[model samples]
Target: MLKGKKIVITGASSGLGLMTAMKLVQQGARVAITGRNESKLQAAVQSVPHAGRLSTYVLDVTDAEAAAKTLDRIWREMDGVDVLVNNAGFGYFERFIDAPLEHFEQMMDTNYMGVVRCTKAVLPQMLRRGSGQIVNIASIAGKLGTPKSTGYSASKHALLGFTNALRQEMRGTGIIVSAVNPGPFESPFFQTADPGGTYVSSVQSLMMKPERVADAVVKAIVKRKAEIDLPGWAALGVKLYHLFPRLSDRIAGGMLNKK
Candidate 1:
């Protein structure tokens, strides 16, 4: 379905971003992948199936000016951007009091503002063409504030809100705005979120694989889903939250306690 499409995926160096890029390339999409690390981005270029169809750009989404320039360059080079996957984000697991104020800034900058800047960069073209897709990779954390994720949760919640509002605003514009809210997955996410390696140990076996989430993302784009949650069961918690707030908090707390 992605044949001849030009897609840009931020944070495509490793983990879920890389996997999703690979999946799109295999399906004949021309993918421009961005990352802060040149080495990791190059490695991802080599690992995908259609190497000739892949482009790599060194982009730090936290840098608003740089992100805008890079996105503009990619769009011009590709002639147009058919899809934009805003997947660049990171998180930390820590007690709110222990997490430095800078850490919260990092979360909001990269996770929330990154999406804002990149989306703005692509808007003119998408709006002019009257056709496009913007995919925001959010998390289940956005739905329920899990323990040790105060900053991370807040950023994702903001992203989710942004995605919802953007989708509604573009309702008659022929643009697709969707958010993928995946549960904890077996990716480098935990390694980055819990650099000390203490939290990932307990739920190692339960973590879903990156490929699973990638497949879901691909499917969502094809179907033009407004929002989706991976692992199916994970969506139930979100539903429960709307039905019973206090009970939902207890449920989320219980899951975090296991980690």
Candidate 2:
């Protein structure tokens, strides 16, 4: 469905972002992927056939000005962006006090404002063209905050709100805004998030592969679904929590207690 489409995916140096780019390229899309690491970005495009269809830009989503400027330059080079995947973000688990304020600041900048900046960078053009796609890689953390994920969860929660609000504002326009909330996925996330390895190791059995999550994201873009929770069951739990907050809190507390 994406053949010949001009698409951009941020955070494509590794994990789900890279997997999503690979999948889209396989579907014959012209992909312009961005990352903070230029070498890794170059290496990503090295193995693909029709490599001419893929381009790389070194970007840090936290820098709104740079993100806007780069996207503008890429817009001219690519002709125009038909789809944009906002996937640049990471987090570290910490006791709210153990981590310095910078940790939370970085998370908000990369996770929430990053989406805001990128969307603004491309939205005007999309609205003028009257059609486009914006896919945000949020998490189940957005739906329900987990212990040790205070900073991470807040950022995602803010992202979810931004997405929903933007979706409403874009009503009657041809632009489609969607958020994909995935559960824990197997990736290098823990290497950065924990560095110590113990927490990641304990939860390895519960993690889904990046490729599977990427598949769901691509499908959501094609179908223009508003919100999707990976694994499906997690989505159910999120809804139930909203409907039964008090009960959910007790149940959630019990579950954490057991662990």
Taking the tens digit of each residue's C-alpha lDDT, what string does model 1 give over 18-120? 9998999999999999999999988887788878999999999989899889999999899999999999999988889799999999999999999999999
lDDT of 2: 0.88
Best by TM-score: 1
After superposition of all CA atoms, the RMSD between model 2 and the true structure is 1.6
Off by over 4 Å in 2: 254-259
**Leading candidate by lDDT:** 1
TM-score of 2: 0.95
Per-residue lDDT of candidate 2, residues 168-217 (tens digit): 99999999999999987888777778788766666667778888899998
